[model samples]
Each structure stands twice: as structure tokens, then as C-alpha cells.
Target chain A: MTEPGRQGTPLIQLRGVERVYGQGDARVVALGGIDLDVWPGEFVALMGPSGSGKSTTMNILGCLDTPTRGSYRLGDLEVTELDGDGRALLRRYTLGFVFQGFHLLPRVTAQENVELPLVYQGVPTHERRLRARESLAQVGLSGREHHVPSELSGGQQQRVAIARAIVSQPKVLLADEPTGNLDSARSHEIMALLTRFNRERHLTIVMVTHEPDIAAYARRVVHFRDGHIERIEESS
Target chain B: MLGNALREAIRSLGRNALRSFLTVLGIVIGVGAVIAMVTLGRGATQAVSDQISSLGSNIVFLRPARGFGPGQSIIPFKVEDAQALAREVPGVVWSTPVSLRTLTVVAGNQSWSTTVVGAGEGYLEARRWEIVRGRGFLPSELRAGVAVCIIGQTVARELFGADDPIGQRMRVDKFSCEIIGLLDAKGQSAMGNDQDDIALIPLRTFQRRISGSTDVDSIQLSLADGVDNERVLQDIRLVLRERRHLSANMEDNFRLVDSKEIERTLTSTTRMLTTLLGAVAGISLLVGGIGIMNIMLVSVTERTREIGIRLAIGARAADVMLQFLVEAVVLSFLGGTIGIILALTFSFVAAQKLAFPFSPDYGIVVIAALFSGAIGIVFGFFPARRAARLDPIEALRHE
Candidate 1:
């Protein structure tokens, strides 16, 4: 494992990224002229009102969508205009995601959910299980190995989703409203767990949320409005 | 990735157990219907072929051609024509002239109107008639025009009961004929004729005593091995026309009919029925395939959020498509296996009760299964594409 603070290279670079939807008279801009850089071992938060393009930025950052115009680099690969399959390949190898609802597959056990990313990576079964178990243990879910999402509480389910996101040891971890569905205490617990994973494992974390308290947990906060970035704040 | 997709599909099916079972039910009934129809058709074809084969192989029948209808003119078959058939045709094994008429026979007190056919020695072999008791007409008995006849089991039962029928005398019209042989039971024909309720006698005796004429109604011909019926029929016709002194342009006063022609017609009819049944079954299989597609599409819709999550976590579009396609295939294949089992059960019961040869061809089963899988792929594609092409944010937003 690499050291947490030594994020030696520029892991992601974006310049003038724009995403437009529809066509002709119906054309609307979802993301416009955004420039940003995200490095490894960094916890960043993107905050905005609904329809302010925070989700669009998160999507572009996650490689789930491409910008209509711009140059974007994920690690060493230029990925802004990658085809569907190439983008999928990038997601498989270099990214892991946690969604707002915990997004834990309801029927699978907690351990199986943790093992999902490694499945896409084509890791052998025994190795995947071992890594998934270690991730679950790291997230304080060792005894809940066989528990399904429905069997666990909101916090435990979010921890399982976090475990899934980190299991592949992906280059970047993107969390979209990871604690949006949890209570305040559970939200804090999820944030603490995510921060620990970022600090201890040196995982790059990009979280999207509307809560200022959630954004405060990150080292940097980026605010967006009306499809454009408004301001960026750095805190010790 | 493939494993995850499979595990997810299985889990989804388990979660919605009732819907899944109902979807599978459609496939089950469709496949079952196809197999049942096909099996019945196959059995019918086999039964018909067996019935035809039960009749004598390489046997031909010739009927006298009257002026316009039966009993109009007495231009019936003659012994001369029968002799000419035996001597002239290259592959002719034997020929026998026969005359048949219905008459009431009285033995002790029992009386029954049974078919009494007059034939020579060759008729027994030519018609596949078996002797269960006594002996067939001997050459001396035939030449002497002795009033000896063979009785079928049905006739014997109606007249003799448990008593020995051989050497018993029965009154036919006014003359008495001694029973010389009893033919084995032959059951019923497709035309519903009672084949076993008949009596056989020497043609000479019938011509001289019973019918009061030397004219035969029909001539039965048996050919040697490897003789083609078409060529031999042509030879028989040509020889008979020349012997009868009929002009080439004139219509023949005799009809030479090959039993093989009847065999061909029956076989073609059976084939037609088989085709019709198979086509109907094929429609069911197609319906089963469409059911699979419909279910798969619903599955795609229900799993959109899951698909979006997978996409976010690094699944390729092709992966999404393959997952759903495999699910559809699994459902169809399972249905096919169950259908084959059901078909076998139906066939076994039908064979046991109806005595038809019920056999299911594994080749057809395999073809049906393959067809089902192909349908799954074609139909599962659209929904799978929808899942793959989903906007992750929009999908996550879906309620």
C-alpha cells in the first residue's frame, strides 16, 4: 500500500469541460466550462442545490459520462471522449463508487456486496473473498459478513457499500450523497469511516452532498450553481 | 463480472418469486404443448406404417373391370389370366384367382353371414393369411374341386365355439363344405373391415358349385424379391390386353392395382398430418420464446437502478446485455427440460392405452431448446440495451 499523504502525481485533470443535453431549440447545458484537478489521497466535496450540476460533475468525475467538449485525464489516460466500452473499462479498473441509498444489492450478503468491484476486475474468487473480508473488517463489519442489506441498519448498510467501493483498491473513490439517507449520527459515523479509509489507505475521495457539515469533513469544498462552479474553499 | 450478473439475476428471481414462477409457467405450458403434439404425430405415423407393413409385402391385387359398374357385365378374372401372370411376368412368384361373396353358414344350430372367398394355393401366401389349425387346400383337393374350405377364428367362434372346427361340415347355400383350416385372427382394417370373419375355399370348387360360373372376381399376385411393382404391373397389363385381344386405344377390361400404391397414399397422408401437427407445436415454441423476451424486458426495467449501480462500479455495456441474455436462456432451457419430461409422460400413457408407438426424438427436443435460446437473445437485446445505455444519475434518481 502507498502512503496516505504522498499523492505524487496528478491523478485527474480537467479543462473547459462542457456537457449539453437535447438539441435544436430544446438544448440545455448540464455542465459548462469547468476546470478542476483531483489528486490521490485527497478528500474533496462537491456541494450545490438541485439541478446546479453537482451530480453532473460527479458523473464526469466517475467516468460514467463524457463531457460534450474538453480534455480530461484520469491517471495517464485521456478519457473525456472515450467510447462506452472504453469508459466502462476505465470504471472497472480505476474507479469505485458509493451511492446515496447505500446501493447495496438487497439480496446479496454484506460480504458479497463488498466483493462486487473485484468481480468486475476479474479477481480470482478466493482472493476476492479475502480482500472483501479485509475491507469489511476495515469498515468495522467483520461479524456482519453474511447479513444482507435489508438485515442491516442504515449505517451498517452504508458501511457495506463503502466496503464495496474500496474493495478493488481503485485509484479513485467517488461517493455521491453517501450519507443522504442516514440520520445525523449515522451520517457522521459514515463520514468518519470514509475519512479514516481516505487517511489510512491513502484513497482519493470525491464526495457529493448538499450538507455543509458533510462538506466540512473534506479538506476542500467546491460549490456549484446554475451549471458552473461558484467558489472553492480549502481548510486545514 | 459474469458471476456477479448471474448471481444478481438469480437473486432478483428469488426476490420476486411469484412473478418469476408465473413467467416460467408460460414457458412450461408452451414447451409442453409442442412436445405433446409432436409426440402424438410421430406415434400416429408409426402406427399407420406398422398397419401397412402388417399387410403382405410385395403383394398386388387385380380387380376385373366391368362395363361401367360392378355386376354390370361378367367380364371377370379367369384362371387363364392367373396362369398367364405366373408364367409370363419375369419376377412373378405366384398368382391366384379369387372370387368373394357373402353367405350364411350353418354349423350345428349357429348361423352367421360370413365372407366366403374362393382362392387357389397362392392366395394364402400372397395375402399374409396364417393357418392356425389343419391344412390349406392341397393340389389334389384343388384339382378335384373338393368342397373343402378354411375358416377364420371369428367364423369358427360363431359356428364351432370350443368344438374342433377341422373336419366339421357346414352348409353354405345348399351344398356342404368340410372345414380344412382355421386362419389366425387378423383384427380390423383401417377401413373397419372384419379381416378375420371370412372363409377360404378352392376357386375351382366355387366356380363349379357355388357361383355356378367359371369367372373370378379378382386375381392376387405375389412377386419375387427385388421386383419393382411399377414395371411388373405394366408387364401384367400388356400381357393381359394382348391375351384378351383388346385394341391398344381401347380401355382395358381389367384393373391391375399394386398394393404399394395404396401404401404410398397412406404414407403421404400420414406425413401431411405429421407436418401439420409439428407446425402447430412450433407455434407454441415461438410463443414460449416471446414469453421469455417479455419477462426479460420487465426484468430490465425492474433492475434499472441496479444496472446503474453496476455501471457506476465499472460494468461494460456488453456485460449488461450478456447478463440478461443468459437469464433468458436459462429460463427457456429449464422449461425445455421440463417439457421433454412431460412429453415423455404423455407418450408413455398414450402408448400403454392406445397401443400406438410413442417415441420422442431427442433431436427435436434439442432443436426446440436451441430455438428457445435464440429467441431469448433476440428479444432480450432491446431491454438489455436500455439498461446499458441508462444515464447513471437519472437511473439512480428513478423511484
Candidate 2:
């Protein structure tokens, strides 16, 4: 598992993690005994087809779901043992998320949408505004802060979603099909933006996508099939 | 967190202003009706008690009971009966016999119909009535059955126009009588009767010239302070029964009504009416609450993706719950405020139209306000819980 550029402990670690839904007779395994590690500053993409458990793994990584069994650790904290509220607190302070749908509140301005994470983090209004503006500027949406999601184009809206994700300065950013709704050019722009954030801020990111071209942006790619990791590959 | 939630709630409600307003209309009507009913009811009770008090405290009305059976006949009391009761009953300070007849009186070709009350000495004192202008009847005038009368404000205004009524000659059915005094205006009785539309004459003059009989219609008795009214009433019943020669098996033909009893009855009746009206109005408030619940549930379902985004973005279940709860509460509270203002305006106008005092019951107002808030919490809880408990992934997947 050791590579030349990798050093120190993994920021996220999963050991024999499994997620099962329903009970006997109706039981289904979404993730079956998965094991993975993501080091700090790493940009890893998870690739798989439909029902291949890639989304489930991303959900677990984002602290939006819990493993039915086995230990999942984010930094030093054991995430699998945490309750809903405790997981929520971890997400609030240590993680951010970007969805496939660019789920900005339809009526809220871009500025307010970007401030949502910090609002949950209990940041004061003035600091929240400043941080939100800075985050929006980082995503190349500098003057579009007052526009509602419906008023913005799809690319602009996705940028606002990106700004919202990173406004809290979380330790990790989880993107589930982040550019699935965009055209090819827009998709490349969004990937380039993610790459820049990863390189400049040393922000760790875990992304799930089916497109090989999108996966090409990640330094390492993990392929999944039938609720288990099929193989891991290095791009260079 | 609360401030953000409140701002969010207000913005969300503002997005659908017409729907929000329509949803709260039930609450508005409910609270408005309750407040107006309670206010008018309180005013009515106040007017009744005021009229009763003006009739003097510790007073009683004694009258011959009407015959109930076909062959039975009512035997009216004579003037001597009132004097006898005053002499025989302990705690009785004074008593006066009264006879009433609705008659037309004429002065300077101005003729108007009015009630003529034939009362003996001490009648005005027993009734707590005062002479606003001119003097009361002289002792000799009452004894000699002289043709003299005291006109009430309505009669004075009707018969003499703007001119002074005292010393004016007014013609009754058959004789001319000089106006001895003018009685102060008492606007209306609890029963809504015109109290100032009457003229007062000596009992003997009414008996000799008008009715041609010696029968007294009713007697007004004023009692001494701190006297046991029940004991005095029982003594009066005994005296009347003995004087009328009623057998032990026969029922007394006289009925006595205490002013305090009438006051209690009227006050309680009005209070009961207030409660009934308030309850009927409360049903509408309940309907309003249901409306809030229905709309909130729809909101939760319609905003499923929004809730998912909020949850996925690290908002706690409690935070989401509070957001929706605050929305519902704000809607109902706004309705409650509007209802209070509308009720006050309505009650003021209604009070003027009905000729009763306008009294707003603040205690009830506050209670209704808090109750509306409680309704929000109670009805909003289910929908809020549903929103809070939504699965983030599934909700995001929802359209």
C-alpha cells in the first residue's frame, strides 16, 4: 500500500466494513466487507456501474450512513460507533458534500446557500458572510452571490454548490456524481476546479463517477463491482 | 440557530403568500368571533348589573302572582297592604305601593304615549331615583290626592319640547295635573326597556281619577343594611298570607323578587352565553389548526429535497424540526394578531349598535393568543417530525 508520494497515517480508514439493509428474508447487502484507506491530500475516484455499491461507499465516507458492522474511522474517531447526532456533528466540523443534483435551496440566494454549512457550524453572521464570499470567489462565482439557484445556469449553480461545500473548511470533501448533470465542457471545468482545490488547499476528496474521463482527473482510481472493490489503479 | 431558522421560515412563507394567508384564515375567524362574543357578553353583563344597582341594593319587589288555572283570579294588593308590610316586617326601612298604566298625555297639543306610575311617598327614595330638576311632591299633595305629577326625561321631552316641564299643566285621561318634578334620565333597563319613558303620580290621584279603583300593582321595599334578606322575605310572605286569609293548604298569591337574585341570574346567564359562543368559535380554531397541519405535511413532502439537502449538509434532526415548527407557529401567530385587531374593531361597532358598554376582556384575549400558539405546536408536531426523520439519501432521490 506504500507509494513514493504517500506518507503518514490515512485520514480515513475502513476495516471489514459492511452495510446490510432490512431483516432476514428481506435482507440485502449494500456493502460487503470493504476495506480502504485515504491519506491526507489524496484525490481518489470510485468507479462503478449501477447498484455496484459505489454510492453506498461514498455515503459511508461522508458520514451520511453507518456501517451495519465493522469499524469505520475518520481520522482518530470511530465513525461506525457514532449515533445520528454524533455523525452529524462530525459532518458539520470535518466533512463537506456535493450532490449530483446541485441541490441548492431553490429560493435562497447563492450567498445564503454558501453560508449554510457555516450556519450549521455556528459561525457568526459577519464571519459567515465573509467566508461565504471568499468561498464563492474561489469557485469563480465572485459576483453571482445574490442570484438564486433558478436564476443561475446549471454550471453556475454547481459552482455555488461547490462554494457551499467548502465554505466550512472541512477536512474532507465528498462528491457523489458531482458533474453528472453538466455537459462535457462544463464537466471538465468542474473537475478542473476540484483539482485546483485539491492541489492548492491540500484538501482531501473522495469522488464517485461512472465516466472514465472524469475518473482520469483523480491520482488514483478504485473500481467496484457487486458491492466489493474490484481493483485499484494509479493514473501515472 | 433559532434566528437563522426564523429567517428561513419567514422567507419560505413569503414565497407562497396567498396560500399562507388562506391557511390562516380559519384561525383569524375563530379568534375574532371568540373575542367579539366575549367582549359583547361582558358588556351586556355590566349593563345589567349597572341597571340592577341603580334600582338600589337591598331592595325587593313584591307583586301579586298571576292566576295559573282557568277559574283562578289574581287578587291585587291594596295601598294599605304596603303600609302594613312596612309596619310589620323587621329590617324594612320603607315601602311604597306602585300602580302602572300605559296612557297618552297631552300638553300644548303635543300628545305622546307613556307609562304612568302611581306611587306613594318614599317611592323615589326606595327606587334610588333622583329629581334632576324641580321639586318632588309635597306631603299634603300626596295625602289629599291632589292633581300633581312628576315627569321623566322622555315624557318631559315629548310633552313639553325644550320648555321646562315643572309647573306645566299636562292632561291625563280626564284631569289636568301640574308637573311637580323632572326625574333624571336612566337610559335603558337590562331587559332593553326604555326606563325614561314614564310619568310619576301620587297613588291616591291615580286611584280616584284614572283607574277608579284602590288596587296597588306592586310594592317596592327598601331594607336596612346588613339585614338577612331571606328572613325579611319570609316575614313578608307570612304577613301577606295572613292578611289575605290564605288557608294552610293554599299557596301564597304573592311573589317576591330580590334585586340581588335578579342580578346574579342575569350575570350568570350572560356568562353562560359567553362561554357557549366562545366554545362555538373555538371549533373554528380547531379547524384552523387542522388546516395548518395539512399544509405543513404537504410542505414537508413538497420540500423533501430541501430537507435532504439540509440534513446532508449537517443540520441536526432537531434543527430541521425547529425550522418547520417555527414556520407553522409564525403562520398561526400572525393570524392570531390579525384576529385580535379585527375583533376589537368589530366589538366596538357592535357595542355601539347594540347600545351596550364596550369592554374588552384582556384575560380572554391573552388566553386566546396563547391557545393559538399551542395549537401550532400541537398540530405542527407531526409534520415536523416527519420532515426531521426523513432519510437524507431517499429524500434527495425524491423529485
Candidate 3:
């Protein structure tokens, strides 16, 4: 894997980003002014208790939500300046996400679930099928391609979701508490798979979790509290 | 992308097959009722025109008009009035004074209740009726009021059965008459009355032997081909008014019934009824559209998380909207197809039962199909907009 310090330019940069909700009396601050940078090929973890703005930060990074104030840049594009559709296009071409709930469409088979992102990209059918199968195999789900979400175990379903996120070869994978519902053994297996992708493909990763044991799998860990980044530490 | 959206729509609808069917049931019933009503209404209108045209297009009936009130009296016409109209009116090709009475006629122990008509010479020609057997009345027989009669097909069947009615004797109220001719069958009139259940005798004979009065009920006239009907009618009115001695300011004690006028009135009335039925059925179609809207709203709400998933995975809002819209369209289109089939079957059977023509209006069928699809687009829009506008962050958080 490439060393984070060896990279001259960060792949992702956030400068004084702030997110606010509602207005007037109903106003709430979900994220205070914060600054951060992530180089290419880095596995980063965000850790905080509930309401610490970690989830909010992950949402903003995934382009699912926009910063209310300040600049966010993914590569050369200014994300905070983009419109809803523009941000959606950015997500479609550059970002992937694995959620805590493993949000696979309930009745769709694993192969179809993995093919969704490619479908959104207007990929042709035969090639889409081939890529989806390859992604599923990469996640160690070769024979479970036709099984629906309800028929699969939680770990297998999350793997399918991971396969879906990475199927289009996105530049960055944003995983929010991906193993939150899995057992300790399944969580380790999932963490190892994420780590292998990060090293083997040099894919940038940004993950959020509350557990230190899970945070330990990343090369760097950032702690958050009360809508602000408290500190960040690196590990060899 | 369109193909994918369509596949997605079909798959989602299949997930709730029972709900989808129930949702489209309203549309099915609405379209079916509209098509059946229009188809059957057209058939009834066609039947009316056909029946009226069968009565001969150039015929007109002149009858004494009763005054407005309930107990008002009517002045009967004389046979001389028919003769005067026939001579003085330019377009009057044939005219006959007709008097009618319902009587029970007995022949060889077989008796039947039927109408007995008293008419002057050339009555059959005025009515465009043919003598299917035997002969018409002789001039001497008609002028001398002889006891000879002609029987219609229905009268022949009821009084004589398979035997020849010509040369047979049937008893009128106070006299016996020999059958000299047989009239062809005319089937039923527009009013559903049996037209062929009648016996015809000379007017003088009827006046002398049956009623002992010289009163005529009505005058039947046939206009010559290509004549101006209104001019001829005005001429007849003038002649009748002078003969009956009506002053210039007095209303003539007569009324004219033209075949064309009757046909127009009847057709317009049936068309109005058809429009009324179509409007009522259109209201039901609107209700069906509302049902679709209601179900689509529910479906969007139920699939909030799915929308979120799609959006989070980088699907455009338009994509999500298209999927739901296509689902609604497919649903209503399916209902339209089934409704058309049901309507065709129902109208076919009903036409057979009602004894009218079975003519399906293909234009209306095509219109109903397209209209049902339009309903989907119109009603499905609001819910689709709601789905497309959802915030992915909140939607993903929804359980």
C-alpha cells in the first residue's frame, strides 16, 4: 500500500465544513466547523459516541448531504458548490457506500443488487452481469448470486452490499458502521475484506464506527465529539 | 435506462400482486360500463332508424287533433276529406281514409283478438304493402261495400293456420266477410306493436256493416318521389282547413305526422340518453383514477427506504419518478384491456337477448384504452413527484 505522507496531494479535502438543520427556534447544529484531509490509498476510521457528528460527516463525504457552509473538494471538484443532480452524478462516478443496515433491495437477488450501481451508470446488460458476478466473487459470494437478501445471513447480505458499492470501481468507499449488526467473528471477516480491497486496489476508504476494536483495523483513527473533531492519531 | 426502469416497475408491482389487482379493479369496471353503455346505445339507435325506414320514407299520417285538456273531444275526418286532399295536393300520389277497431274474429271455431281496419281504395299502395296471395279489392266490391276482406300474415296464421285463408269466411262483429287477399308479413313496428295482426276491408263496407257510422279515424298519404315534403304538407293543411270550415284565426283541428320527423326525434332522444350514460360512466372512471392515486401514494410511502437506497446509490430523482409512473401506467393499461374484453362479451350477449343489432364502436374502444392510460399519467403524477423529491438522508434513516 502507498504511504499517506508520500502523496503530495490529498484525494479528499474538507475546509471549515459546517452542516446545519432547520432554522430559527428549530435550529440544530449537526456539524461544527471542521477541517480534514485524506490521501489516496488511506484506510481512515471515524469514531465517536452517538450525536458526535461522525454519521453526519460520513453523509457529507458520500455526497448524500451537502455542507451548509465551507468548502469540500473530492479530487479537483468543489463538492459544496454542486447542485443536487451534480452531486448525484459525482456519487455515481466517484463514490461508493456500504451502510449499517446492508440496504439491499429486499426481494432482489444478490447479483441484481450488485448490478444496481452499474445500472444507474447506464451500463449495458451483458457487461453489467459479468461485472456484478465478478464483484460478488471478490466478496466471497460466488455461489450466492441468486439468493435474495431475506434468504441470506446478515454477514452475507452486508457482503452483497459491499459488492454493490464496489461493482463500478468507484474511487472511494464510504462505509458507515458496516459491521454494526454483525457478530464479532463476522465483523473481523468483513474488516479483513475491506482491508484487502484497500491494499490490493489502493481504494480510498473512510469508515465510521464507535468501537475501538473495529477502529483498530484502519491505518488512522479520528475521534469526534459534539459536532467537532476532537483529535486524530496514526498507527503503523 | 428506460428498459431498466420498466423492468424495475414490473418487478415491484409483482411483489404486491394482490394489491395491484385490487387497485385496478375500479378502472376495469369503469371502462367496461362506459363501453357497454355506448355500444348498446348505438345498437338501439340503429334499430329505431331501421324500424322507421321499414315503414316507407315518403309516408305521412293525418289525424284529428284532440284539444289539450283530458276530456277534450276530437273531430273525426270524412272519406270525402281524403278524396279532396288526393285531388288538390300536388305531391300526394295516393290517399286513403282509415278507420280501425279491435275485434275478436271467429273462423271455423278458431277465434283471435285482432285489429280490423276499414280503408278506401289504394290503401295497400299508400302503405307500400304487397298482396302476397290472391288479389286486391275490386272497384265494384269497394264502391258497393261488399262483405269481402283481406287478411294479414299474422291474421292468416291465427285464423286459418296452414290452410289457405283466401275463400275462407270470418265473422266480424255483426257480419260475415269472405277473405279475398293475403297481405305480406311486416313484423313489428317501432313501438313494438305487431304490425301484421290485422284484417283490411273496404271503407264503405266497414261504415255500413261494422259501425253504421261514416267516421274515418285518419288519412294516410304517400308523397311522390323527389317532391318538396314541406310544400306538400302546407298544401294539405290548406285543403283540410278549408274543407273542415276552420276560420283564418282558428287552429286547424288536425295534426300531421311525418316519417322523417319521427325518425329524427327518436334518434336525437336516444343520442341524448347515450351521452348521459357516457357521462355517468366517465364519473366512475374519474373515481377509478382517484383510486389509483390513493394506492400510488400508499406505495410511495411504503417504499420510502427503497427510494432512499436507489438515490443513495446514485440514481436520479427522475429515475425514481419514472419507475413509479410506469407502474401506474401498466396497471391502468391492463385494466383497460380487460375492460374492453368484458365489454365486448357483455354487449354481444345483451344484443342477442334484446333483439337489436350488435355493433361495437371500435372508435370508442380505442378511446377508452387511451383515456385509461391518460388517467394513469394524470393521477400518478402527484405521488411520483412526492417520491422523487424525498431527501435521501432522511429516507435512509426511515425504518
- Predicted model with the maximum lDDT: 3
List the global CA lDDT of all models. Answer: 0.82, 0.91, 0.91
- Which of 2 and 3 is the better model by TM-score? 2
In candidate 3, how many Å is residue A204 off? 2.0
Q: How close to the true structure is residue B269 of candidate 3, measured as C-alpha lDDT?
A: 93
B1-399: candidate 3 lDDT, tens digit per residue = 889887887888888899988988889989999999999999999999988877776889999997444665788999999999999999999999999999989998999999999989779998888999999999999899999999999989998899999998999887999999999988888889999999999999999988789999999998998999999999999999898877787776789998888988999999999999888988888998999999999999998999999999998888888888888888888788888899999999999998889999999999999999989889999999999999998898888
- Candidate 1 per-residue C-alpha lDDT over B249-277 given as tens digits, one digit per residue, 9 for 90 to 100: 66777777776677678767877877777
TM-score of chain B of each: 0.89, 0.96, 0.93
TM-score of chain A considered alone, across all candidate predictions: 0.95, 0.97, 0.98
Error of 3 at A142 (Å): 2.4
DockQ (CA atoms), all models: 0.72, 0.77, 0.77
Query: TM-score rank, highest first?
Result: 2, 3, 1
lDDT of 1 at A24: 98
Among all windows of ten consecutive residues in candidate 2 chain A, which has the lowest summed lDDT?
Answer: A1-10
Best of the two (1, 3) by lDDT? 3
Model 1 residue B362 CA deviation in Å? 2.9
lDDT of 2 by residue, B6-70 (tens): 88888899999999999999989999999999999999999899988877777899899854446
Q: Which one is best on TM-score?
A: 2
Off by over 4 Å in 1: A1-8, B1-18, B24-34, B66-74, B160-163, B190-192
